[model samples]
Target: MSGRAENMIQLIDVSKEYKMADSCRVALQHINLTISEGEYIGILGLNQSGKSTLARLLNGLLKPTTGQVLINGMATDSPQEIRQIRQLLGMVFQNPDNQLICPVVEEEIAFGPENLGLPPEEVNKRVDWALELVGMQEMRYHAPHLLSGGQKQKVALASVLAMQPRYLVLDEPTSMLDPLSRREILEHLCRINQENHITIILISHHPEDLLDAKRLILLHEGSIYMQGTPKEVFKDMEKLKAIGLKRPGLYQLIQQVEEEGYRIDDNIKTIPQLVEMICRI
Candidate 1:
């Protein structure tokens, strides 16, 4: 959700399809997108709107059945080819436990670089840097099973970042955390993007999650329904509601104010921003 704006990955005529019992199940179609480096994009849409499938395509987990996902000018094919692409792109999942296959935290973070055949010094350096990046260095020796839900997810992200991936593909990375923990994880991610200039592509449903995006893209029925800066996209409150997307609580309050005969800009995107606008008015 709330994201930065920088593109690092590009998709050219990307599409995905699966064979069903009697017909073909098309998951994505003609997804032509450009993800600039160091940008954080919040991808939202209804279920089965190709959000998840799109995330899989970014880091090469699932290859497009039709087109190609170009990662830093390289074409990817299998999981092995993907391994090379992943050197620049990293993916974090919704469920941290599923991603945390190893028992210890450091081991999980090291798995990626080790697989890439880096020297022990390099792996150790990455492990240290990534842990420090996510503020998880102290827990490197802890058991994954013993960590909190938010901690686990952060650890998963650190594992990916340790690979020094310039592009980070996150599929609902905060979905499972409690509200406070969710905020914490998102804040840390924002710091990573701002300070480290890492590109972030986040797939999420919550409008609140998208508050920080330099851009927001909504995928609907296998196509882009809408896309713009959060202020632009969230302005279409009625349209978003029609698509089962809830506006932020602050937005709803502003809508209420407008209906009550108050003159409002109707373009406010966040609670604090709205407050500032109202104060000046």
Candidate 2:
């Protein structure tokens, strides 16, 4: 996270509830958070932990039942400002099928910018740029529905990237992907955050999916349970297990080794770092 970057998203005492036939279900309860520009944040939780609800709140897909959500200081509850808010914030959901609507890949990627009424030349530039960013330039003319699952997800991502949003929010974007594809998507997110300086708010239940995040916010039931960097938050293994979240296997192994008095450098995060630590020992 950059110290000088301004706050791009803020949830001030936010809560959301859904009305059923006879009763109401509280999906979120008083979530107060701030995400600064150029930060990669992970929202971790099990099912029914308000992860999806929070994601929707950020971009004004759903208004808060109580409190407020602000994007770059613009209130989401304000309909007049919502269009601009959404333009500044882009969301990528779990299923690519829900987002991909165009017949061709380039057309799908150009949808958002085109709707913004950009000139043909500018739209074409964005379409080409987004496709290249996601490595989908080769498939620009291909039909979106016929692509493989991973490819479809990439196309979906390219579509959002074409909008060139300042903040990107992903809700379980890799849940439907295979292991290799999931890894690829996560790597793409990390690269986007670092190279483009776009703020990334990734929601997932998998700890491994969030390893690249600069900070982790753990949600339980309908409120925030804990928040910190990956090392700080995942250190409480028993607490995470109690909340129905699993730590990555490598993280578990490293924790156990450290428990036995082995000195593992705090800077060591990935497998390569762990291997180097072991070699030195």
Clashes of each: 15, 0
Candidate 1 lDDT over residue span 1-281, tens digit each: 12222234667788899778899988888888887887888898878889998987777777789887777666665555676777788889899989898989999999998998999999999999999988898999999889999999989999999888888888888989999888888888888889999987888977787777778999988888899987678779888878888777876777666677777664565678778877786
**Candidate 1 stretches greater than 4 Å from native:** 1-7, 78-81, 253-273
lDDT tens per residue, model 2, 128-228? 88888788889999999999889999999989999999999999999999999999888889899999999999999888899889899999999999999
Clashes of 1: 15
For candidate 2, what's the RMSD?
Answer: 2.9
TM-score of each: 0.87, 0.95
User: lDDT for every model?
Assistant: 0.82, 0.90
RMSD of 1: 4.8
Question: How displaced is residue 259 in candidate 2, in Å?
Answer: 2.8
lDDT of 1: 0.82
